[model samples]
Target: MTDDTPQTRRPLRVLAAMSGGVDSAVAAARAAEAGHDVTGVHLALSANPQSFRTGARGCCTIEDSRDARRAADVIGIPFYVWDLAERFREDVVEDFVAEYEAGRTPNPCLRCNEKIKFAALLDKALALGFDAVCTGHYAQVILREDGTRELHRASDMAKDQSYVLGVLDERQLAHAMFPLGDTVTTKEEIRAEAERRGLAVAKKPDSHDICFIADGDTQGFLSKRLGRAEGDIVDESGTKVGTHEGAFGFTIGQRKGLRIGTPAADGKPRYVLDISPVTNTVTVGPAAALDVDALTAVKPRWCGTAPSGPGTYTAQLRAHGEETEVSAELVDGALEVTFTTPVRGVAPGQAVVLYQGTRVVGSATIASTRRAVAAV
Candidate 1:
């Protein structure tokens, strides 16, 4: 009779998401350098692989897949391409159109991170027997003493991407790896690293625009996607100022391109205050109307443990933006936040990420906002 005990390996298997950019290429190299058995995966999110435009900013094209594969080769790791165009369209593109039609601005990158990279993609990796999935996001995932995972801002605060990723739950964080978190690597540094390694994506410009909107035709895309519904552009007093092609064309707090020449009595710049999809009207007002103090966010997703009572945290309404000190309360699964200083133009449907110092506590979708009923 013999007794045997098997030992697990120190280095783990990781799947790094490569987007044909220097950041992602460096991420794969860092993963390999960290002693992990890394494999690069590029998500193909366009039906016409050749139609994937890279001159401007976009992702998930055949060319991008090839660049990612080349980077993987340079890093001495295996590579594969996964066709996720259908899922991306359904989860991100359709949702963006729907939200615009509803007169609410949507953050498609946040949706992509939540549904695609961390959810669907993570599931696929787990099924393939990978211990973790890595990305080039400038954010950190810290494991707490109680075995719960927490998200944090990256070392490069200016490049930190924690806002869009705050919606991730603990389960996703447990299997997620952000290779570029601890380093203060600028965009140039990543590219230089890629060039030093002779990676194909060394000089690949980062994707700046939404992947689906290759021509940067947001208005045209919305018109085609949501169907043109004629609307009236009105002033603060509900007086019709001009006509709009559709309600989906405007968003809250937009300042320019109203095309209304009518001069106001006060000679102040008119900004977008509200948009009504039902009446198909875009309401314009003075810039004063954009200021908001309190905001309500629905579907709050806590990072580790859900807040049980009223607490103070820094709240950021926009991604890659500044955080304002605020008091947050967990009320019936929603977060009611009162900014310490008035935050202007906080729009609905934007993500509100709460943080305690450098650690991301939770996040929610902004459902409503107004002047603070009470001071914080």
Candidate 2:
């Protein structure tokens, strides 16, 4: 049995992943204060950290590494920087590009949590004799009487990150620790805690958007990686409305930058309804065309035991998206979910995470969506 097994009150050897942010720094401190033997490690994700964005917009930069080291010093824990640049590039970065190339809207953050943080990092920590991998994610881990663990939402719903972490399976949940999960405090309160703890990153701005996209220009980034292949943008009647440099630049439900030459007959704004990588074409239509009522998701990953059959639950379609009631069934490894009410903006390659109330049941990569018949 692992040292982190339920009912074990012994001091655990915890490896805290410090991202040079206030949350992680304080999480490490709290773990140490709770008598865990904690060590701080920063993942050097970018091959050339200098080229990545800096300050409030970036997560893995040279500045971030330095800040993590300083936080470790202040917390009096052993610190190290692991060069996971190769793994990160292959798993997260390359996958992000490939997904877009396939005309799917992939969430790199969810992929990173599944492929890099929980799988790669947790595996390495275990090999190095660490009992658990701790992070600053605002999600709770519940230990049941049978020594099993469950992942649940954080106390602060606004700050809850269980959606992105729904990819963690049972094995990963066993060795995971979230020190900031139960706190009902606000972001300012967390920062104040960091200030009181004498951490220098107390006022550091939270990183936003895709970290690797340094300038926040996702279209420009993809254009550089995938190269510009001018494609036609057509309406529902198969009439060309506009042209784009690449079909990969458009996502489902995108409204702006379509560069449509003609106005709609109804003059209602059109949205990106579909992107076809095979034909290199983007399809635009009315907002009603974007309504999705059902989804067929692949690669289902359950946090604990897989559900026995179809069950009613709430499903979160995106990172910050609201959860909607859904009836989910696991059939031949795919998750079939039907939302009680139709949802909009759902895209393939994004995850559809199901929840039984506040507990994260599992997540799957959205393979396809069924448009609402009423909208048709």
Candidate 3:
């Protein structure tokens, strides 16, 4: 394995994506400090920047742009704002709504990283002669002796973002730089470093939830986009129990806000077991019904080389979720994964990232799931 230090690498032109957060600002500063020719750029992902709320948890806001510009000024690097609102809306926002409408939960962050950051932005940077596109993502790119690259979790597992970044293919990994990956420091330490470097966003609050949905109300956001179509909330046996304005509002394993008037026969709480967009129905059942033992996924993106056959790996079902042991293999251009034990709440359309130790093996979009035989 190549030395896990950025200092040993030769100076090159780096295009740092400054997200107007403490992490990105500090990352840009570190790149410039290491003698790399770094230029900072903030992605304007909102078409109507004025309409988006400006505050701690909002991303791509005008305030965020200003913060990014200020940080670039402090870092002594040229700053620019790239208007990617149209692309973001088409790729990330619309994709999110579509996934929901199809009765699946989607991770917009993963889509943004895949389509906007890596595909669109990275391509543009490379066209402009930049050798690499750097970001504040808490993940590492390990270069092998053979010159191939591998993506891995950050040293600080608490802040590791490799799950969202699992969509990066080998080509994208070649030109990606993550300066914060190897650091064992806490997020507070990163903020302190930014303060020492005179970066104004040192204490800026981190953005969370869906950036496009400024209000943090996902149900409201989807309703506005897709328009409400009243649907039936039914039990697993197809018995209607309640009604919802939109079936898209529900997701697998959701338990609250179901508005079911009558309790279960056994007086147990009911969890969302499935959603059928075609029939416009949401299926709820006992918590035991949510156990998933196996899943099939499509569109696998390998970080390095694709696995040759079946392998024992750890699979992360969602971002910030715990990794569970799984046996995975590629079959007929799809990924089939079987867990060592039943995992709950494995939903379709979510990316399942596979890892062998700390290194990211690949990721695939879950297509379907199967319950354990015992549970069935």
Candidate 2, residues 204-295: lDDT per residue as tens digits?
A: 99999999988899999999999999989999999998899999999999999999999999999999999999999999999988889999
RMSD of each: 4.6, 1.8, 1.5
- Number of clashing pairs per prediction, in order: 0, 0, 0
Mark the 10 consecutive residues where model 3 has the least summed lDDT. Answer: 1-10
Q: How close is candidate 1 to the true structure, as a TM-score?
A: 0.94
lDDT of 3: 0.91
How many backbone clashes can be found in candidate 2? 0
Model 3 TM-score, 2 decimals:
0.97
What lDDT tens digits, residue by residue, belong to model 3 across residues 1-376? 1235453368889999998899989888888887889999999998798556546666788898999999999899999999999999999999999999999999999999999999999999999999889999999988876778899999999999999999999899988889898889998899899999988888788889888878789999999999999989889788999999998999999999999997899999999999999989999999888888999999999998899989999999889899999999999999999999999988999999999999999999999999875433
* lDDT: worst 10-residue window of model 1: 1-10
Error of 1 at 8 (Å): 13
User: lDDT at 320 for candidate 2?
Assistant: 89
| CA RMSD (A), model 2 | 1.8
